[model samples]
Target: MRQLVTVSCVLLLAVSGFAQEDSSQPRPFVEIAEQDVKPSVQAIAPIDDTNVFFLNKRGQAGVAKFSPGLSLIGWELYSKVKLNSLNSLGMGPNYSLVTASPIEITQAFDTAGDGSLDFFQGLVRDWQGRDNGVRITAGPVADSNGRLLFALSPFSIEEGQPPLARLVAWHPDSEGLQTVTESQLLISSFSVGPDSLLAARLSMPAYTEGYYISLTGLPSFLADSPDAVPDPLPKTLPSLLIPAELTGGKEPTQMCFFGENNQTKLVLTCPESNQLIEIVPEKSGSQWQGAILLRSQTPSSIESVVEMNSGLLLGGGPDGFFPLEIPAEAFRIESVNIAKDGIVLNFSEEVDRFQGVKPDSYTVKAVSLRGDNKTLMVEPVIESDGKTVILKTSEIGKGVVLRVVCQNLPSADGDALFNKTVFYTIHES
Candidate 1:
């Protein structure tokens, strides 16, 4: 066996507590630190410190071995084996998840204390529908002793009916593939942990009902091989988006992001078209809760804000995000379709509020003074909270150009006090 260890270090200099303060900036921002990443070979099915299988997107199946440093040592390819399945290989405590796909296809990787790769490619004859090809996607979960467990799933679609999905396990020793009992679930994305397996699934019609799952099982199949490891605890992850609550106007009305803690995060929508509620912890013990709004700034076509879990918010200007604060009062308008609606001087906060300008106000106005200026009128729909405004147009012309502006934005504080402007066009087509 080969062993390799790598470490990294960073240094910074700080002044004494009596250091003079810089009036240029009042608030201090914490630096986000990240650990250095390790380097290694990328494999289709990587197991333990010794075994790593490679895959060919061109449809070939094979396994490759390398030294701890990642130098290729040897390889075995089964070009004759047709790839009806695809997935990233992973390992677990007793058993590992092998060949996971959108389908419920799976195999439990277990061997009788022997260090050898031997097992049947978990397959279900009727797994895929008649019209679809038979493909099983498998990936690694974990490795214990000389064995590994793999998550499996099948993918197929049919008309007049929701697709079917199943989960199975595969062993690498004497016994080949053995079917494991699984819930009838529609899995979309998943990941495996040291003691639990996390998965995301959507109900029929895709958006109706969604959920997350955390599962653990025994090493040896009690129904088949009782001498194996005992089953572990099961935990379920929560869905990123909760349709019932969002549609009903809950605190976190819309789900904007959902994902595993520390490892990764996922954003569900655009911020400009949607609101970015703060990220919260989930009860599933493996994910975070997020909320979003569904308002667009452009001509309903140009997306303004992008919601994401990590990195930074995209396209919110150099400071990120247009203002959301608006007047709360309401007003009425005659029609919906029209051209240049005239210059509406919208602000980030209510026009009559006494608290002074808030840190999150923004605004946008018309593109030109001519065209349809005389034919359109601008009025506040929610004047109190400054959320939205109404523009009545006499007719639908070529296209309408609207400009957006912002003020008192927290991120843009020291740079500029004046609100900025952006343009959006309205079209009949």
Candidate 2:
């Protein structure tokens, strides 16, 4: 009996050690089922915290559902669709898959009319209006009303010919797929605003510079006659374009609407100059007039901008995703004045210390009446408030054409200065 008791104690201690060792081990970053497949995921669309849909590079698509701890609950791969190129993916109501591809955009059906589903060819319209060929770049996005909207630009490979672009709306109908819209702008990006109005960024090869166009008082269509052609968009509807000066001479890339119903506002992203612009309808003007609200800096080039429950998700970076909160007001140069002792540079916000703030960072040129340019050496001093910088130089005097070139000046958060050159004629005072 004594031998048996000692053996039992030893066994109990060994089991306890094993349990402690297992408990101390760390868990995996994410848990997936053994049957879960792994694909080369290029883009991910979050249906919710626990559900996501992904599109792979080879045109394969799948939906993944996860539990609270990210354990895979279900995974379903859809039938592969042959596409020339796939750009974006969206989910419509009833788990319908919406994609923007080079192939003819269509609903799931026997497109071949052979009484069988075989992904073979797309419907292409040639100059003769027959199915032949054309290259198209399009992006499809689903709206709240279970409709798919596409920004399509069709171009030919032939040299020196640029095709027109337009915005198209697709709806399900008994006769067949119904399409509508009369926009002639080359839409880079767009979003549905309040009351289902359309807001789009229009730019093209002919004029690379972009601007905003908003459509108001658009009419609704309930099932138009199949035989009749869709009516051309009415011109009397109020359309507004944000001023070009406010855009800093750069093209607007993507945009989305913020807020709900009557409080909605449009936010545009400009990639060339790294700017986020906001525009709101003016209270007491024609419907076409809109006032600029803010223009701020963004850290990365944005390809897609989507508003979510938490905030905005900016995609098309090396990391594939970045969260954008409401940015703090940006720092900007307010005024430049010629003082008795030095040149006073006033800023809208506190300036940060960087290589740009050094006196050597500036190129001071004194232009003579004979078109001679001479460099001026100076020393920079930051004021106590951090909003003012004084440049002391002997080369600044009466009748001198003073040109200050400031470059690479960054804010505390690393936002570079936008405007580089400041010119002034120093008069006797």
Candidate 3:
């Protein structure tokens, strides 16, 4: 390792906390304190809520101090790997950092403890798939134990070979990687949900050009050798969305959970769209399913995300860093519950009770698998709580996706509803 260029962590926190606050003009974001790392930033990982480390397209790794403002205390060139880009970053065991590139997964260590991540090790390298031009997508996702999972895809599939992608697992103590699940639809952007069934975002060309948000009852592979690519996940994906509006454009490539200890959210970052989408994951029985809502558009692209202890959100993209705040209640749908009769709509804020009782304020439609659609005029009932509106009707079908749009439902707090549309996938009971 090159002689470490160090910055003391003690001074970083102190300086970072002194971020000058301005109250005259109120904004949701924390103080602006990021220094641009110009080479197309791909991912970010928090050493803690107060500090972060970032990787760029040029394969350069750097550290920044953030509380209020971001201060680039130090950075390092990392390795002689000549890698073009680093796609993913995650905090590994013992405060060490993990990163993924097209060719390898590496871990960085601040062994000397001078606040510089000085030591580098290729934890999983010479991966077999790289020969076919492997691209590591999501992960370095840590389980309750310290083991890691990576989603991988190889671009060049030879004729007669399985046209497949994979979810690979690597143990820190082991010398190699193992196949977690190999599939024609191996997800590179997501993983198992609360039900332990893998819930993933699948690129569905059949639906147009967008991703098919999926919940699967697929079986994981028994861990095998590095070269052992396993069976493909069943093609009859226990999925949602009968092709809907998820066509023509792409969904975000990266996803993260933010807003810790409060309202946690799964935020998906799309650098191209300059928008972060929050996907609602709902589990019915053994299947995990849900919808994707355009959360908020950013001033800059966001490729990675993390939430600070102070509840402020931070995002990093191709152009560098951005300070962000969670989507205001006005720009969110607090929750969507499907009822046997109709559907219950929940607002993030106290919505006007009068509008909740108006059938004219609601537009309901159901799309069945046979390309059949049914429109409904529901009998609306405002619940005891002003935050929820219950619409009752058996007009919606059991096997169709119900799309509910609550229009003219103004909030009592004078906040306009940012999104009135919700898609509820009704699976076979």
Our tally of clashes for model 2 stands at 0
All candidates' lDDT scores?
Answer: 0.31, 0.50, 0.60
- Write the candidate numbers in order of decreasing TM-score: 3, 2, 1
TM-score-better candidate, 2 vs 3 = 3
lDDT per residue for candidate 1 within 1-429, as digits (tens), equals 000001010011023332222233323221222223211212244443433444344323444444444434554542334344443444333332344443433333323322222332333223333236433433333433333333334333345543334333334331333333233454333333222323333333444432232232323434345233334423222334333222222222112223332422322222233332222222223332322122222221111222222322222221212222222222111011222653233333334332123323434344332444422333323334442233333332433434333343322123332223333334223
The estimated TM-scores of all candidates read 0.32, 0.50, 0.74
Candidate 3 Cα outliers beyond 4 Å, as residue runs: 1-40, 68-83, 111-114, 128-135, 154-161, 191-199, 205-209, 216-250, 258-265, 307-312, 318-320, 327-331, 413-415
Q: Is candidate 1 or candidate 2 better by lDDT?
A: 2
lDDT of 2 by residue, 284-340 (tens): 232433334334556665544455533343333222334455434646654566677
Of the candidates shown, which would achieve the greatest TM-score relative to the real structure?
A: 3
> What's the C-alpha lDDT at position 300 in model 3?
84
Runs in model 2 deviating more than 4 A are 1-46, 49-87, 106-137, 151-166, 177-179, 208-212, 223-232, 235-250, 260-262, 271-273, 281-287, 293-295, 310-316, 328-429
